[model samples]
Target: MTSVWDLPDFDDHEVVHFVHDRISGLSAIIALHSTALGPGAGGTRFWHYAHREHAVTDALRLSRGMSYKNAMAGLPMGGGKAVILADENGTKTPEMLAAFGDAIEGLGGRYVTAEDVGITDADMVAVSQRTRYVSGLPVSDASSAGGDPGPFTSHGVYLGVKAAVAEGLKTDSVRDVRIAIQGVGSVGSGLARLLTADGAKLVLADVNNDRAAALAEELGAEHVASDAIMGVDADVFSPNALGAILDEKTIPGLKPKIIAGGANNQLAKAEHAQLLHRQGIVYAPDYVINAGGIISVALEYLAQRDGEPCSREQVMERVGRIPERLKAIWQESAERDMPAANVADAMAQKRIGRA
Candidate 1:
């Protein structure tokens, strides 16, 4: 906590740029974990952290996750992430967006920015006005591979959950399978809809009570308090919210046979992977399963850079491979008597030239 190098989440980051613009009230941390593969590519998160240290931790952890995510997803991009520290009121302005974009521009293509939690495509547009190193922009056509990456993320997660069900339960169908989802936001809600259509019974929870209730009512699913989601008796517990929820304090209470979702850094620490393995739970490594969004945006960015058009079909083709990667991770986990998360980390590390 005293020095960034001493922080537990700091994973030998390539560059950690701290930006402070008083006139625009922009305070941000941009952490590039790796650029060995290509430019560090990831999204920008706008969130209110109670403490500055927590914000730094998030930036560090998320940037490292992005590196693994991009590497595992087979993208030329490496990994990086940006965090804009919001105040208690979560105030955001155009000036802040422009300044943030300027900061990204100053990186000189080493980093590319997109949209993440609490950041919308429109916000990315504002950020784009100042920098060409921005993506997740609204597209002119629905068939184009550019826009909010939420649906792409949800699609990959949905496929990953299905893969988990097949691997752990020895069944290819999700029909009547019980799934408890933590966080009914954009990604989670899209996942719920997909699973609902496939005849899966879902238990939904989110910090926004009303949103959870509405989605549950619409899907004919059950709703629970966010804190109580982990204890839900279900076939799979999908965490689509924040990270570090699966630690010593929560893993023992997990009632699911499989854990799969789009949340980044689901494990609080590296050792926690073994705890889940000891519990006999099949885990779909978060980065491996949640690479859909980055795949979409990375492809879009590459296409734009090369003066080519990116199609939705191309993105879907890459996303459809998520299940295959999860299958490989789970297989290695079983063969090596290792946690799936650890196996995934090893694979990703090799991909990023860290191993």
Candidate 2:
């Protein structure tokens, strides 16, 4: 097995903690990529990786992404992530949650966790019983900024897609424009509904066939097989799925003029950004467009820590700036003949004192 330090994704991570609780059958990895700006704040993902090493790699990549994401979003928090290793059956229990919570408590506030894939706000509530360093708890009022971060993320991506259309297609209107969306999960579905209301032609795909079919039917859009989505001729291809999907094997076949979505770590490697640029596709850095969720949760945590109120409207106001940041990156990319991902990375690195 390759050592963690030798992994390509390991980018000078400050801490990588492996956790095990035999009694609760809990096994996890908590990674802190940086604490230069503030405490490491990110989400917890509960996933079943075929290999334990894959979990470590994911923790490394995701935690680093969170660092960049938070810095670019102008948040005071740094970056960290926790990945709970699930069994083959994807079993999760209260005991496992409690044990994970205890482990987080042991971190002494250096890391704060919320919700991510296979994790829920309710699970955060459970985790909070063991530690004060948590966010994404269920808010009693809908006007509050803290809760499920999905809708916030969707809103930011929707705005980014519109920005991409304006930049690449030279039009502000999405009406009658074709958009092929991959992964009709919470974020994708929310983006689809928003675009549909704007009269954008939609093609939806997801690994969940039933969900995709139903969303297409409801939105009066078209549905395609997950594998066929990239090949669909559309003005935009929005990937809301897992990371590393935009690698060499897949980028050449993509027919969209613009690639923008809420998926984190979309590029398999740094060079793929140039690949997309060479293909003349306008790319939105995933962390920039997807910072809405983290912004909401981070603000919630900060507000709670300071005993202040954070409103949903304030969160929306912050999220509304996502498109502007993306536009700036795009502008710099064009001026310098650089990929937008590279531009965004340089800016984030400078902000985090990494440059």
Candidate 3:
């Protein structure tokens, strides 16, 4: 079955399609964005789903968010997302990836897929056998440049947090800011490193105590239990964990002056942005702030397809623009006295109009 979430003003569609497999009870969710600006390019994620409804919801929301993220980041690519439900830990197995690859191959080029949260470069290599619609995957040693894009994402978020803090705290530097980060995953760990380098005092928490402790030690940060992060007195609250963490229950308990993070879809709903607004927390829209990975991958995909090589320098400069783009959103939100989410939506809509 397919469900469509139409962004009427933007003339784009987040098409949610589901595939329920007989074997493994594997359900695949595909979100197709048809050329809001250009090709609908995104990555494929494979995960173990507790429920089919959850997968569909994630696909639809992620697809729409990607559209906004791409449009706001000034990328020609539109947005799409694919999810393959399998084991609890996401399949690294060739067989599972092959099945997931087949699902993407069916989408044609309207949705150019790439490496996402659960998928890897090697997995992209597996998908490449099925379709040419995949990106963020280097095909060879010369092109052998595809892997974790987490660091760049963290860098962008770091800059984004800096911008949010500067504007929210009325301070030019992020130095001395107390930042409590939930999640010590790839993106979160990288963000912690950057924040530490910027002289911010850190409080770290993650579900995985080993990783949390490792990262805390690396950054010389203090550690806290994951759920206790919201109560931590801090200048910046970064939710680098899963989405929906900023819902009504959590937002009201937030003590940060500025809220920024690498997590996708930090707000559970549009109203949460207003809640953050009411609390005087400068909420950097997740889509706008954490677009660095997609941007880097898409550019590389374009280069490889067009016979041009992707350079690290160009990608870094592009990633660096995240702060500027976010600053634009922040300023617009302030001037309009609206939620940052609205400003982000408006920015995306404007791009679609231009197209």
Off-target runs (Cα >4 Å) in candidate 3 are 1-14, 20-26, 89-92, 138-146, 353-355
Clashing pairs in 3: 140-144
TM-score of 2: 0.99
**Residue 110 miss distance in model 1 (angstroms):** 0.5
Global lDDT scores for all candidate models:
0.95, 0.95, 0.78
Q: In angstroms, how far off is 178's CA in candidate 3? A: 0.8
Deviation from native of the Cα of residue 326 in model 2, angstroms: 0.4
Q: Which of candidates 1 and 3 reaches a greater TM-score?
A: 1
State the lDDT of candidate 3 residue by residue for 230-292, as single tens digits.
Answer: 899998999887788888888888778888998887777777788888787788889888888
* lDDT per residue (tens digit) for residues 1-355 in model 1: 4899999888999999999999999999999999999999999999999999999999999989999999999999989999999999999999999999999999999999999999999999999999999888999899999999999999999999999999999999999999999999999999999999999999999999999999999999999998899999999999999999999999998889899999999999899999999999999999989899999999999999999988999999999999999988888899999999999999999999999
At residue 216, what lDDT does model 3 achieve? Answer: 89
What TM-score against the true fold does each predicted structure earn?
Answer: 0.99, 0.99, 0.91
Clashes of 1: 0
